[model samples]
Target: MRILESDGSIVDIFAIYWFGDETYFYGMPKNYGGLQAYKADEVTVIDNKIDFKTVFFSNDDAKSVHHWALIEESLLDDLLELDETAYKRFLDILKSEGQLDDNFY
Candidate 1:
């Protein structure tokens, strides 16, 4: 993953694994701090630094948080263009957790 900075700069992105089927957005604190999931449609950026919010379980909730992350429009766009195979992998993980309703695929 790539984080887009306010000044159009891009930074490497990482994830903190957790249980459940939902995709989570975490705020990575500077200087090696623990990550926190974001809730609500809020995105915090201090002097171009990213901050945390809370986790959402539905698409609407996810979209709200996504809007907040749009501070870096290009970066958000890049994020939306996700790799299909990676997405499938995510679905696989969800299936393993028994989060998916059907295994028709």
Candidate 2:
């Protein structure tokens, strides 16, 4: 994530997951997350949209969107204010959503 020095496809995948309506594609340590992202599990982490979805949360409903709305908005501001710790905050979310493997440590 070093400006133009970073990989563009990663940004594209993140954008598609955040904004795309029909397809989603993203690869990682093992090709996980987001809609249409091929791989195993086909369960946790959208098992289908490595991106963002309702099932990722518990007791989530239309009202729950507010939590994410705030997180989404704040992430940008937080990232701008503190790059060192900004990205780490998301690890917890991903872990809770089952995207990050427990053994990863």
Compared with the true structure, all predictions reach lDDT values of 0.35, 0.32
* Model 1 TM-score relative to the real fold: 0.25
Error of 2 at 78 (Å): 5.7
| C-alpha lDDT of candidate 2 relative to the true structure | 0.32
Question: 105, model 2: CA deviation in Å?
Answer: 6.8
Predicted candidate 2 versus true structure: per-residue lDDT over 61-91, tens digit per residue: 2111212522453553443344435445544
Best by TM-score: 2
Write down the lDDT that model 1 would get: 0.35
**lDDT (C-alpha) at residue 103 in model 1:** 43
Which regions of candidate 2 fall more than 4 Å away from where they truly are? 1-14, 17-48, 54-73, 76-82, 103-105
Look at candidate 2 and give me any clashing residue pairs: 33-50, 34-49, 34-50, 34-51, 35-49
Each model's TM-score? 0.25, 0.32
How big is the positional error of residue 4 in model 2, measured in Å on the Cα after superposition? Answer: 20
